[model samples]
Target: MKENGIYGLIAEFEEPDQVLAAARQARAAGYRRVEAYTPYLVEDLAEELGMHNTGVPLICLLCGITGGLGGYGMEYFAAAIHYPINVGGRPLHSWPAFIPITFELTVLFAALGTVIGMLILNGLPRPHHPVFETPFFEQRNQSHFYLCIEAKDPLFDRTITQEFLLKQKPAHVWEVLA
Candidate 1:
């Protein structure tokens, strides 16, 4: 079914291998934008689906470095340049003094970035998803394996896509409602 520019197709598999095989077939058939849900991780599914590496970790790293540098810069500016407080003959730029706060900020930013990046990447805080409308999908966290091909696929058409999914020989295939 299609709604709000999102199209859903449901395919069920009796075993993980079947799901993986279906994913491979879908990939060979030029279906790229698809998602699979399973109770457990499937080793070859990601590769079979041609899902590429994500940049969330890289974003977290960059944000962490920025936080560290920002912390250090703030300390440098406050103790060395902006205020220039020389207490008890201590150096204006106390590298050791900046270590604690810099480390703390680095970790804090990295953690915050990781969380925010993950939420953003995952489209989280979503109270509802079209996939949930599939009655069989409740077993997604149990024993079933499901693959959904979104309507956004350039080559997607309900009839042809359903035919292709059936060719995969899934145990049961149902339409994912929009």
Candidate 2:
């Protein structure tokens, strides 16, 4: 279905098993830029397609640590240096008093960082994707599954990819146009 310049090749499947098998086969063929669209969740599909660890957790942890340190630092500066109001002759640099705010800030920054990191990693805020251009893309909501191997994949070649998808025996293979 090469209507114009190719973005990639998309294979439509009638069943989850078919798409899953196709994905596994694609991975075995060394296709790294494969993606799958299904009406419902398909177990192990992500793993089969080679989706794995990302940096979101690391980002969250770093943000949490920074927030905890910042919160503690702010309180320390205010109590020990900026204000230093001695309450009941208690220590002005009381670290125990800073625990609550530090904990809150750590949780807050970690949550915010997780949300932001996920959005960025997923390439969110986009209004369109080339797969949407497929005339049959809407079928994805009605029990169809689609697998796409993007042109950006190092192993991608239009003819070769199309033939490869054809070998999977999909319902039909379409060229996803950019």
Candidate 3:
């Protein structure tokens, strides 16, 4: 354990199975604030962490609806109320003509919502994090798998958490400092 402030205790594993097992054990032991890092996606990892649901779909839906309405509203006001011009003898509020712009705006807003919502939800734009303080953490980009139990967890105790992590038989364990 670190003499100073601690962010968490991270266990390094050589295989995805080890990380998965450690995460499962941590959860079973009533540790809620846990996270894992790996070079690639591990099947069932998110389920083990209980992190399935996300709000991105709902955000995209609402944004797409708003964009469609705004697009139609803009065209309606411009062609019918603001500048009334009978082009090609069509009706002032031509539904077919509005379809193209509305569709485009719906797609654009949905894409934007996906990007913005992901950034916001994932807490992006963070150039650095305390987890980087762990030794050999940079190796996560290669073959290593990591499981971290945060100090902020309600059930966290330095000695007990470290002992629990040790029972998982990790290759290395380190105290992540803030």
What are the Cα lDDT values of the candidates? 0.84, 0.89, 0.90
Compose the digit string of candidate 2's lDDT tens values, residues 1-178. Answer: 2334678889999999999999999999999889999888899998899876768899999999999999999999999999999899999999898999999999999999999989999899898888899876875547789999988888888888989999999988998888
Which residue pairs overlap in candidate 2's backbone? none
Summarize candidate 3's per-residue lDDT along 1-178 as a digit string, tens digits: 3234889889999999999999999999999999998889999997898788778899999999989999999999999999999888999999897999999999999899889998999999899999888887785647899999998888888999999999999998899987
RMSD in angstroms, all models?
2.4, 2.7, 2.1
lDDT of candidate model 2 versus the reference:
0.89
lDDT of the structure predicted as candidate 1: 0.84
Looking at candidate 2, what is the lDDT of residue 49? 91
Worst 10 residues of 3 by lDDT: 1-10
Q: Candidate 3 regions off by >4 Å?
A: 1-4
TM-score of structure candidate 1 = 0.88
Taking the tens digit of each residue's C-alpha lDDT, what string does model 1 give over 1-178? 3445445788988789988988888888998778888888889787788866767889889989989999999999999888997699999997998999999999999999989998998899999888888875775547899988888777778888989999898877777756
Q: How close is candidate 3 to the true structure, as a TM-score?
A: 0.92
lDDT of 3 at 82: 100
Which pairs of residues have clashing backbones in candidate 1?
A: none
Give the poorly placed runs of model 1, Cα more than 4 Å off: 1-6
Give the number of colliding residue pairs in candidate 2.
Answer: 0
* Per-candidate count of clashing residue pairs (backbone under 3 Å): 0, 0, 0
